[model samples]
Target: MANVLEPYLYLQEQHGFGQNKKSSAPGEEGSDGKRDGEESSDEDNQAPKEENDDNEDEDGKSGSSSSDDDSEDPELAKLLRENSESPSSSDNDEQPRSQPADTERKGKGRFIHQEYDSPAGNISILMIACWTMRFPVMYMDFVRLIEAYELPYLDSLRLLPPSLTLHLTKQNIQALSPHFAPTPMHMHRLTSRLAKLMFRSYNILTPECNAAPLLWRAVRGLQGNPTLYTLTKQLAHTLSLTLTIHYSLAPKLKKLKTRDPEHHKYDNAPPEVSLAATVIVVLKLVYGLDGRKRTPKDIHDPACALPNLSEYLIAIKELEERERKSKTSILSASSTSSALDMDNDMLDDYLDFCEKALLPRENRNIEHGVIRDYFPLTRHSSTPDEGVRSEVFEDSLPDAMSAVRIHENSSDLGPGNAYAIYHTQDVLGSLPEDYEKIVNRAATWAGVEEDYVCGVVERFERRLAGWWDKVRREKAETLGRVDDEVCRICIGQLIQHD
Candidate 1:
């Protein structure tokens, strides 16, 4: 046994492990020119030396340096010594010691450290894997793989990382091509997954998130392909439904006060509406229907040959109409009539009481239109002179004409004559004492009460003004767009005579 251990000891000595037992500066030579321990002079002895006993064996193994020695192999020990003395190792050596072993192990199971790669690289790998296996990969699984790789959600998934995009495009073309004869279910799964992933990148509030370019490319590449057309239409349909739901819920949301003190804002429309609107606009632009020259003839032209263009147009029109009606309904509720005819009659009676009891004779002659003219149309105006006259004219003209026509047509007095007759009474009631006497004399000559004449005129004036304003607003919003070429086309179509 001793003979066998002698060879092991010789091997360790040859590898420089034997030199570790003596105290001497590294590479220092003794006076006799041999590397070995030697007593130093007073100046060299001033430097402290580590207290390590080579004679004490803790592990019951002879020739062991120390129980705390990090390296057991002679070569490893030399390398570690060299590394510790290097300049680069100084930073690492100065770092704080690691946490206690128990502390580090406590929460180690909760998290995992994963390596990340660019979205393109990961997607390419996934595509290759799926193609090699010739099996349909679940969308959720694909999403999971993306998440596992910690890839960013790229909006340009359909056109990015040339290799992956080319593969996807090739697969799509083959699936849609008649020559390929691919399995329908397999094709459906693959395309559906791709669509879902592409759509996922679309965020309504993020202005940069746009899927239109990719979609347009797909349409152009697969032009005249029924499968592609159906897919595109389905996407548009989904967006339409989303827009409808948002519009429907907008009015019902509670009004929120914004930072502006004068204006009360509401969180009515969702962010999804912006996304849906953008997509619709992009689709229109893609088909060339968004141009100023768009017309019924252009829309119906067979030469255009854009698949689902008509359906998209119709869907967009319907959405716009629905949105318009919803907005109009809300405006009508707050700014216009909300009561039935019966309620109006009751309100009229109340106004009559106020006119007779509270209004002085001098103040009665002040016309409603004249009073309205002195007020600004909106709160931002500093002067009432801006729109007063126009508003007064808009309010009073049409009702006056209708009242006069009714008076000329009616042979007998009845509820049908109430508007004309009451208006005359109101006017007479408001007249000054001097005008009253003149009006009374004229009424007596005409064989009618002065009050009756005044009331009929007043009622007729009020009705005419209200109706005129309504018609003006409607015309401004509809037929008034003569400067816009698109509007001109639409109007020309409606008014065109055969």
Candidate 2:
């Protein structure tokens, strides 16, 4: 009782309990005297009989009113009461609103890029495996096998050591060669066509050069055969302007003098002037206006001179007039028509030159007295510029020049200082007799000479049989020298000489 009374007394002293201020609870008004009076009156009206009953009722009312005063207002209390009410247990199992699929989470299951460490020794081994066997028969067999096996074996094989990958790739190519023979003539035509296509592809001017190396390699490979090179070179000379323009190798009306400054054509001419001027001079020569009238008797090169020089000069004069007018109305409709007509004429002349050699017929030949200026023609066989010719031909030729011989001059075979690493009795001695027959048959089918193939196989067998013996015989320092030599040879072998 004391403790309870003490707390009540503290509240009364601290907060004026009897004479109320604002009531804090729900359904209760701010209490000055009015609210207290109203509460008392309500209690009085309820049941007033005995003094003891009245006291008990008043005390009960006071406690109830205080509790009520501590609670929220009715509106707020109603809201909170509704919120506090627990949702039905069944609501826990209710379905929710549909959600969008998580694309990023779903996409994580795809392939990833991984790097593998490779040693220089491994790279050297791979270089030998792939390139030393130049168009080796194993390559053809492997390619054919891929057709049979698909890429499953191949993808897995490359994932192995790099040398193994190279060996497998070579085998694949060798196998596929029969299926894709690519005859020399057809290859030539294909390369020429591809070169023309590359000339037209705008991608060359773009930032990416992905296709250039491929195109260049194909063309180089096609040109590897000599006959193809001759055909293209001849085409270049006779129809120089037209062909260059056709391939867009030369800009229209742009001069192209030789890079050599001492050449007569390059005397103080503006950079743009040489290319166009050279083309014009060549064209003039082709048209018989280079101070020479080639008659039908001049049948050595008919494509050079068609009509007489005067007629060609007159035509050029007319073309020059059109060129002058083109500058004023460039890119306009009229100028465009004139330009097209001129291009068409040039193309026609170029085509005629290509179809027939520039030689006149016997009937048009000059009698002993015909006074025509003699123009000495240089033989096409001789290269005018040795430096340029060598560079260009070296890139295209199948044979290497003496200066650039890529293959190391192998000394007459020194004693084959053969050494084996793995144990032999465990590997070779245990092989069944049938293995030789299988290997022999495979080698035969792959186009290797039986004796040579057998030699390599026997060498391998020997290595397996006497591995420990060989290892014991060779000192570690000597082995190091041998390894260094092997590496140099392997690297040297990769150079494509031809």
Candidate 3:
């Protein structure tokens, strides 16, 4: 339920906008219209040094912050104690790490400002109450599962925060200026890449594995992937750009004349469903291999069951054109007046702010280091007595990895080879010693070089994958047709399960 009228302004008797700011506003410069109080430094312009919360581990996942001194803030101290006691906070390096408290820190004398937040991320949680529980429920002891394959770092800076592009505010409208605009390339690269990967990697994340992707994908993209749902919703973002450069938004998508069928039932279909159908059209119109080309057959493809998408695509195209014309008319009217410069200036700022908030990479030049995407996976130095785990890249991971297990009774491969098979559970091959020290220790106990042991592990890994595949299928069948809302909560609990 969206508010028809947002940013409710205060009455004259109430706390007017900026009333909390000391004395008068900035524009009230000495009768002459100059910036007031500039000679005296205003603390508002000076950004306070905010402490970054991301403390990354060797596996590149955000770990507990080492800033554990309790005496500074009693409130924080109490929080730390509580978190330490929480079951979800894990000691295992590979398990889900404890999230730091989300306290908004401020410097001394800093004014209290309402930090911007979005509900799109929490929408899945909201639907929990509405669910009938008809969908299959997943069952897994997450604590054990994560301890086995620290999955928290699987996507890194791979999902965008919901945009405020459509929810423009009075202050944001002023951001239309060129000075406030963001780099076109920055906006496209960060938003596009993160969204696609978040969707395309569906079912690829592995067994009892991560709940993040499923939670995000479900109830997204009109009962499909989110690539289109989000993209279409933000189509208004193109209006934020300069008219001269708007061509860059979707240069490859040529305007095509699509005909409306007279008796099509899709014309009366749900707005969201119709909008989703149009995404494939735009994908096909794009001149590159980026989105590939989507077609009517795609809806009926075994991979996708969107039976009605073929008809609804027409509705989406009409909706897109209507929105464009309506928004463009509003802007054109503004451009004809004295407010033209101001409107353009505000759009620039809006784009810049929106980009910084949504992008997971290079945010504020990564100064606060809030996002933990590129933190290097730590490698350990090993002594002869304690064997070393092999060096591995966190980014490049194989599709199938062997799970670590030492079958004492089975003679399939010697204990050493079996131990090696067990360690390859994750794509990066179980993360290094935190990938598991027992693995390194076991190999040493087997009295062989890890290189030789690894050779044996590789030979049996393919055969072991078949066993893992069957396990995943049985689990999926047992928990048939999972409800999207349930997946989010389950994963949410798993994340908290330490």
Candidate 4:
């Protein structure tokens, strides 16, 4: 909750509001027009370095520094310096941080600074409690309701009970989908919240499975009012993006491999459904899709300028191509061995194809590494035979590739033929690997061939992780500063002091 409130101040700052003026007693503004000995704590809430906790001397204070008689403002500076001196100021500096530890709770999982924290808001505290659960009873109930009511329309009607309907409506639909009916503000909020809860629950609560699509239908029905169609489209597009990733990661042919196949069908873990949920949450948080677009549907419609569909598709393609190249070399190497070693090799080939066809090929810049998250399926798999596995992209191939191959293999060709083509020298029967091999060799005749395009993926992974962490930290810090200001205002309202 503190994390959420922190952003309010950021918005205010963005809108050009200066920090709040310090409040003082009636006579405090004195001859110099500055309050003497005013205590101003620095608001750098970056978590403190751990090493500073043990050394009192290095803590932000010079204990022996005494002020001259006329230096009335020195004490305030002293306090600031003292606070800065403390190594653990962020977490444990509220009071004497190095006092003998409270032993009774030490072995029972107690934190050191629990007693010195400032009072927190009751509402915010409740939100914290809710967030802590990750998936709570209410969320589970919602999921159960969604799963039970299977059809799209049926799930919509049943899921929005009267109590839940408090926030249900058509107007809120403007937030995510312009094609949706003009739902009541309340209904829209309820649907949006419910959708979010279900998505989180599906992804974080249960193992990846088929039950996801049922929930998606409920998501789709939220667009009943035609007015929310754009919201629906945006929602669907985002959802598809997410599903594309989920499908890419999920295990292939789960039904054939598992004993309890019924429990994990597409209905249970449909990539599309999960993706839709992902779309809903991301669009809501990052793009403010509903608020900005309102009733607009087109890219230039002015509610908000969304990325062109062409751009998104292009991004998807480029991501796939990188994945294909990364895995193609490995599959080619393995293909030369034997037919019995075909499953693994064929799986890799099919995945390579899916990555190629599904993702957009044009690359403006791959450095952004936005595609990594979606292409996590092709990450190098670690196996005992390091040589064979080393060549494979981090056993990270997406689950959807497996599903597509399974469907194709099961429906049309026998497993042997299916597996054969996947690893066979002939792809589509039109292009022979023998012909392509000579061409590839001829193309690269000038220089000795390098084995693997080493560390390209690893470099991208590192860059992506760093970028993500930076974004999260910066965003969180900005919001933290905002909340601090709000807290200062609240504290002022509660007390009357000089």
**Winning candidate number (TM-score):** 2
- How do the predictions measure up, each by TM-score? 0.16, 0.17, 0.16, 0.15
Model 2 misplacement above 4 A: 1-154, 157-229, 236-498
lDDT of 2 by residue, 27-117 (tens): 2332333445544454432322233333533453343346645663789768866776677733653422222234443444321110011
Candidate 2, residue 85: Cα displacement in angstroms equals 26
lDDT of 4: 0.32
Give per-residue CA lDDT, model 3, range 1-498, as digits (tens): 236334333221221223222222323432222234235333332311111222211223333334633325788667867766745444554242332222223422132221111111222222221122322111111212222222221122233343644565755434221121122223223323333343356522111212233233222322223433333233212211111111222223233345532222222221212222233222222211122223222121221222223333333334333323332222321223233433443343333433444455545463443233344222234442332122122111212222223333443322111222333334464333322232233232222334433433333333334433554455556677445444433323211211
Candidate scoring better on TM-score of 1 and 4 = 1
Better structure of 1 and 2 per lDDT: 1
Provide the global lDDT of candidate 3 against the true structure. Answer: 0.29
Off by over 4 Å in 1: 1-112, 115-128, 134-286, 289-303, 307-310, 313-498
Which of the two candidates, 1 or 3, achieves a greater lDDT against the reference? 1
lDDT values for all models: 0.34, 0.32, 0.29, 0.32
Q: Could you tell me the lDDT of residue 342 within candidate 1?
A: 25
Q: Pick the candidate with the highest lDDT.
A: 1
Worst 10 residues of 2 by lDDT: 111-120
